[model samples]
Target: MTVTDQLSKVIDKTSRLIDLCAALQEENDLLKLENDSLKLSLESREIKKTELEEKLRVMTLARSLEGIQPTELGLSEKTLDIKQKITEFVREIDKCIVLLKK
Candidate 1:
């Protein structure tokens, strides 16, 4: 083959390589964006899961308290006070969770 023909072929190949590189770079950028979005979604879900767990704990405690008899525990006079304190604690936890969401 002539040198001119070889040089032309090299030029054509170089052009194709550059085009391929650009396409790959675009695809890489898109993949990076998708990865970042997925990470953020996963983090949001994890935070929600933690909040749900806290609520479940509060519910469980409330149920346990319900099943107990204040008279049997010999604290009938303090039963109302204890219930009021528990209610306040639940309210505080809810406020904390709301702050966390922000």
Candidate 2:
């Protein structure tokens, strides 16, 4: 082949190589942006997970309080006993009121 033709072929190959390089660089930049977005998404999900765990902890603690027997609870026995007696009295009074209604 003529040297001019060979040089022309080389120039064509170089141009193709340059286009391929630019395409690869653009794809790399897009992949970097996607990677960054994924990282932010993971961070946001982690934060939400932590917040849910905290809420679950609080709910568990409230449930634990529900299991506490009034007698064994922090208040004095006298105070709790008085409150219980008052509740019983109210129930009896309610029953009497219902009977009167009937």
Candidate 3:
């Protein structure tokens, strides 16, 4: 083949390679964004799961305490708000526990 023909072929191949590289870079950036979004979504789900588990634990403790007399619970006769009772129960079971306010 003539040198001119070989040079033309190389130029065409180079242009295609550049275009391909640009397309691949754009796709890679999109994939990275999607991956980051998924990571955030997973983190949100985990936080929700933890919150639900805590609520469940508090509810379970409340149920067990229901059948027991107040004296058994060691709570004073002072008016016990339902919310306060749940908070107390959670604190009794787990020190340093933070209960989400309903």
Candidate 4:
């Protein structure tokens, strides 16, 4: 081949290489932007997960209070007795009022 033809081929190849390099660089920049976006999404999801776990823990603690028994306060028997007496007094008053009306 002639020297001029060989140099022309080399120049053509160099131009193709430059184009490829620019394309690759642009793709790299796009990928970097996507990677940053994914990282932010992961961080926000982690924060939401932590918040949900904390809320669940608080709800669990609150639910635990529902099982407390009056016997634990040492007044179960006394309270029951008082409730019985109140019921009997109410029944007696109701009967007396009925008799008085008649």
Task: Quote the lDDT for 45 in model 4.
Answer: 100
Residue-level lDDT tens digits of model 3 in 61-96: 755778775567775544344665777788776754
TM-scores, each model vs. reference: 0.67, 0.64, 0.67, 0.64
Of the candidates shown, which would achieve the greatest lDDT relative to the real structure? 1
Candidate 3 backbone overlaps, count: 0
What is the Cα-based TM-score of model 4? Answer: 0.64
Model 1 local distance difference test score: 0.83
> Which is better, 1 or 4, measured by lDDT?
1
RMSD of each: 9.9, 13.1, 9.4, 17.0
Candidate 4 lDDT (Cα, whole model)? 0.80
TM-score for candidate 1, residues paired by index: 0.67
Q: Rank the candidates by lDDT, best first.
A: 1, 2, 4, 3
Error of 3 at 3 (Å): 0.8
Q: Which stretches of candidate 2 lie over 4 Å from their true place?
A: 68-102
Name the regions of candidate 4 deviating beyond 4 angstroms: 68-102
lDDT of 1 by residue, 1-102 (tens): 999999999999999999999999999999999999999999999999998798667655765767975556665545655765788899999999999999
